[model samples]
Target: MKTIKSNFNAQGLVRIDSDDLKLEIKFESSQIYLNVISVNPRNLKTFFNLSDLRKLVIDVADKLAFWKFDLTVTWEGDELAYLGQHANPNILQKFIVAKNVEIKNLKGFAKLLGGRST
Candidate 1:
């Protein structure tokens, strides 16, 4: 797995992008929900909001530790049944690291995550 970029925005939005997927998390005030999910497979674009956004990420990272796992994410190449969210980070626009997952890098950005950076 590879680490692309992890960033935090002014409005308190934290975005994490891997070769296979780009996830934007909005777990701050006003919108206490994880609304955006983009995976490697173009077909999975319509399959966002799978579960707890944080848990989903943590799961994906956890799966990376295993070389041979049954569930493979499109970004994974995707995996995350989502056990649950973190127990902390209840503050506004605060991003706490629950777990870190290393995503394998793809050849190109547009083809990897199916979206190119602007």
Candidate 2:
């Protein structure tokens, strides 16, 4: 397993990579946590809102029978944060792109999760 970590400011963006799947989350407002998931990495389009992302993840967990985990998203002041403890890359990618939004920078965008600049 691989790990990625970075600090995010208000409305800041942070991404994580596990195998072929990528996770992109943007800090929308300090009042609430917001994230936009995408498949193929480059689209950076948001298909699932917080509730949507949770439901989809639950459905996938039930279908795949992978280890059950909880995802907590929070934003306080100038901080945007996310915690996803999962093991299914396929499900993750699927959930991210489930809504079918167009990605802007395929290669460039996914890279942002690990080491690309916004």
Candidate 3:
């Protein structure tokens, strides 16, 4: 996991890039916006299977916990375009909530919760 850039203070943005993923998060007055691109063996264009997608969301929710703020996630690249075709906003909220609960249950997790700027 490598941080490309980060500004995690109020109304900030963070970008992290790794071999398998590229994640960008922006904090605003009313919400937190997340943009994710999954790079995997199957597809270079950010294709995500169900398992991968779930894991991505869980990891994100765990690392960045801001329950008070509304969350918005944009799945980037061509493979995830299907989600937009069948969009249901509630699904994302439920998934995030569920993942947040899972994270809370595991003690001593997210040692580097809010990432440092580079």
Candidate 4:
């Protein structure tokens, strides 16, 4: 287990920077909600909903099960939505099990987490 140093500011924002990944999450109210500000390698920043990311992963897993590929998303924006800094492998495993994907390489499937493409 690694320690995540989360930085909080006066404007209700939390930042996490590790190696080559930068994550800026913002909190608006007291309802325990946060919006991802930027999760990228460099020169590229983006924001996306967590729920949307899970859906995209599940969709990709489905397509992978059907077509057999690492990344086949055509839409460019869809690529951005799938990448997130805080996406744990446990989450992926849960989605894979829930989606009934009989794939073991589902872990570390997000090769785009640090903006790597193949």
Model 3 Cα lDDT, one tens digit per residue, 1-118: 9545343445889998988668887878646666775434335324655567557765555445432334555553222211111223345545653434222211111111221324
**Candidate 2 lDDT score relative to the true structure:** 0.39
Instruction: Give residue 19's lDDT in candidate 1 (0 to 100).
Output: 73
- TM-score for candidate 4, please give it: 0.27
Model number with the top TM-score? 3
- What lDDT tens digits, residue by residue, belong to model 4 across residues 19-87? 544545444331112233334533232444546665655665554334322322212223222222222
**CA deviation > 4 Å runs, candidate 1:** 1-40, 49-54, 63-98, 103-110
Candidate 1 residue pairs in clash (backbone atoms < 3 Å): 1-103, 1-104, 2-103, 61-101, 72-78, 73-78, 74-77, 74-78
Per-model lDDT: 0.39, 0.39, 0.46, 0.38
How many residue pairs clash (N, CA or C atoms closer than 3 angstroms) in each of the candidate models, in the order given?
8, 4, 0, 0
- 2 against 4, candidate with superior TM-score: 4
lDDT of residue 86 for candidate 1: 28
For residue 64, give model 3's deviation from the true position in Å.
8.6
lDDT of 2 by residue, 70-109 (tens): 2333222222222233332345455664322223334443
Ranking of all candidate structures by their TM-score, best first: 3, 4, 1, 2
TM-score of each: 0.25, 0.22, 0.38, 0.27
The better candidate by lDDT, 2 or 3, is 3
lDDT of 1: 0.39
